[model samples]
Target: MPPTAHHPAAPPRLDLTDTLVLFDWNGTLVADTDRALRATNAVLTHRGLPGLTAEDFPAKWKLPLAAFLRDLGAADPEAAEQYWNRALAAEPAPLRRGTARMLDTLRACGARLGVVSAAGAAAVADDIRNTGLDDRFDVVLAGVAAKTSALLSQRPTRPRAYYVGDTEYDIHCARAAGYLAIAVTGGYRPAHALAAVRPDAVVDHLDQLPGVVTALHAKTPAPLGGTPA
Candidate 1:
């Protein structure tokens, strides 16, 4: 497991007692970075680019993912997208440890849950079903090129909504969409790397999430789009 950052003065610790919680599928809930890396390397090799090591992948990964591909010699965005989709389709990754427990805890606590992922709808749905979490999410937005767009389209009405993920991109998307961002470590990026983006909180394991959410909710008043002072 990677290090976890717990900044006492992080922003947007909105009350999530009745919040809508949106999750990013890949690194947030699924333990599939290794599988994803392998698939990516396959595509890189196919395109005659040098393969990336696991450690190198996270440090180099970024959103508007086309930029990352371009850095890897994928000059054609459409072709790169196609290759990535095909590679991922051939090798889908599995759920992380304690995924079901975390979902169950949130659901039991009455959090409206959803998943917004860059993966295709069918793939995300299939993974949810395979993991026995078929009915967990109220909304499942997949193959989202821009997560902020998807999030804004939802127009979440709750005073407290959160986007939980494991990358700096996730934090940016969450903030852009007016949701509190919680970045988890032990996924694609290291703790310090995630901390650089200054998410609301960072935890090493999903097991710690319920307590974090509860504590934040308990301390904060319900104000629409409230930011920490």
Candidate 2:
């Protein structure tokens, strides 16, 4: 005889009440760096310029797409931008591993969640719908030109706030907006790149976030910076 089916493991044990967590969309929640690289290559090849390889792309990748294009010697940055966006939408990327589970845990623990991204609204919306995470975020701010100002606008109605992302720029935005920065590895940037920014904490995976939050709350009500875990 087979055992009767029961629900999965224990209920979420972390108490994230009165906490707000914001996440960066592309590399943070969605595994889309490969898509970005492809787009970059498309632009470069079209312009008869040298393309970047996976090994060197991360170090060269920067925010403010316009500036990156300009730096790449794009003659018509606007046309290049259109081509890049089209390439990204051609095949949207999948969500990072444990993304849904982490969101569920955070919501179960009474945390408010949102996404702030530089990705275009159309792409972000398609991603949220395709990934079935449309209802996961309380607020979705996309196509943001200035992240620091954007991060500052989302005031938390809670006692503690955290920003989870994969880039040094994200750390800067989080800290500037007075949120505890939580960097996750295996995104757009490398671990060492994120580490040099001195984020409040760094986790190797998304599933580890709940534990980090628990420890931070239990040990230090106000989080100080931490080493990678």
The estimated TM-scores of all candidates read 0.87, 0.87
lDDT of 2: 0.80
Angstrom error at residue 4, model 1: 4.3
RMSD of every candidate to native, in Å, equals: 5.0, 7.7
Q: Which tens-of-lDDT digit does each residue in 1-229 have in candidate 1?
A: 2235342321234333467778998878988788778767877888888999988988887766567788878878667866776676665577877778777777777677889888666667767877788888888998899999988766444667888998888999998998878888888777788888888777777877777676556666564463322
lDDT of 2 by residue, 123-199 (tens): 88999999999889988998788788887777545667789998988999888887888888888898888878878
Query: Cα deviation in Å at residue 18, candidate 1?
Result: 2.2
**Deviation from native of the Cα of residue 45 in model 2, angstroms:** 2.3
Off by over 4 Å in 1: 1-17, 225-229
Q: List the pairs of residues colliding in candidate 1.
A: none
